[model samples]
Target: MSDKKIITVFCATGAQGGAVARALSKDPDLHVRAVTRDVNTQKADKLKSLGVELVQCNTSNPASVRDALSGADGCFIVTHTDFGKQNSFEMEVHEGRQIADACKAMRVGSVVFSTQRSSRVLGLQTRHMDAKAEIETYMHDLDLPLTCVMVPCYYEQFMGLFKPEKIDNNKYILEIPMGTTPMHLIALDDMGVVVRQIFNNWQTFIDKTIGICGDVLTIRDVAAILTQVLRPKTFADKPLTVNDYRNKKDFPGVSDWANLFTFRMRVDQIFNIHHTKMIHPQMKSFEEWARENADTLHNVL
Candidate 1:
């Protein structure tokens, strides 16, 4: 039998997984295996160039996951979170459990799951957020080295949040439910790098849940940054009350989202204050994110 060790990563074509896989691919120690729904994607080719062993593994298929995890030392699992597209939460949790089972059955050394940041203190009642909690439970019962990373809402979403009245207009509005309460947001590109770093040193981080964030921000704070970075514009908080927000057509998972914001609204000591100290990490700020994603911000505004 070959003595080589592989680190299999799911969501290899998307943002978080692709970033982590690419970082792992650059490491000479571990053999990197990347899974993609479509092997012909630009990201797949990018991974191929980086010397990643590309495989077509759908997370929804247990057989595929087993094959992907075959002989792997570690796995980075991040499921698709867009429930609006295909009712994704159920499928993501189902596949996550499959991966967890494979990790135990295969006796893989480590499993690092990219999860959302929500209150473990205030018990979650919604489906998608609760899925992570359940998956974390399953991972706990497993004999493998398990780590959960609580990634905050990506500041990249602010491009959408600060969308102008029209594309060309300079006016910007940040749509946050909470009234001027700050949020702990991470930059997606930076998060990818941070997650990769965590996976690289899984020994130091195993069996821990990490809350990762780039900056602590409020809608007002974000608006000020956007105004300074993009153009002088006002930040308008969309007037959707809790009841009205839950009744909207687009908010299929409003309850889940509400629980998170409502929950975060109370955490007094900010994320980086306590979270950064514990994690011993410094991440990118909103200005850095805007500069990196200038085109996205410009088009959004």
Candidate 2:
């Protein structure tokens, strides 16, 4: 029997969990058990190729969660909001609670959970964020040895959901709801690095909630960086308010996102970029991320 510590990573095929699995798999002192809904996918195959154990798991099922976390010394968990799904908040909370309950029952030594601030408690109704916050509270109530990591908006959103809209004349407009407030941002890959450090030094993070970010910049700063990287296709930041964003009903979760932005604007110190840099010295800034993803950005245009 190997004496190495076992770490189970839930949602190992997705962005956040996949990064954690890849990072932990590199440590000889730790064994990574990657849990996914399906083990036959290309992403799962890649993890298998790295000598990580893959287990099929449905997070919403209590028995499945327990089976996956049966012998884990530590675990990393992230629950998605599944926005636009009916009762999305309730569904997320259920899934998260199931996982947390399993961790408690299985007596997992350390748990690193990805959670967010409670917009509900702050007088707003960002269901997604509140759902995660509710899960965090549940874990705390269980008296589980837990470390909560709160991530800000992802830099990867630029490639998908938050991609700027192109008007005429090769110009693009970025329409984030923050007028002049600096928004915290992180690369998904960098989250892996930070979580790895947290797991490596679990005792230090026990019962602590950490908010991490790679950069904090206004929408205009983001646009400027994009313009610098993709010069021929100029980018500009639109001065859109939270109310304006809330009025955009064409997209799913508009009100939730609008409330989230409003909360962020009113709140201070949502993320600590300096502390995050201390944890992961090589975390990528927005400019660095934009420069590296310039080709993909161009392709999307």
**Cα deviation of 145, candidate 1, in Å:** 0.5
Superposed model 2: Cα runs more than 4 Å off: none
Candidate 1 lowest-lDDT run of ten: 160-169
Q: What is the Cα-based TM-score of model 2? A: 0.95
What are the TM-scores, per candidate, against the unseen true structure? 0.84, 0.95
TM-score for candidate 1: 0.84
Residue 106, model 1: lDDT of: 81
Q: Write the residue-wise lDDT of candidate 2 on 38-93 in tens digits.
A: 99999999999989999999888899999999889999999887778879999999
Question: For residues 128-234, could you state the per-residue lDDT of candidate 1 as single tens digits?
Answer: 56677667777787756887887777776665532434423456455566676777877665666666677777788887877777787777777677677775544
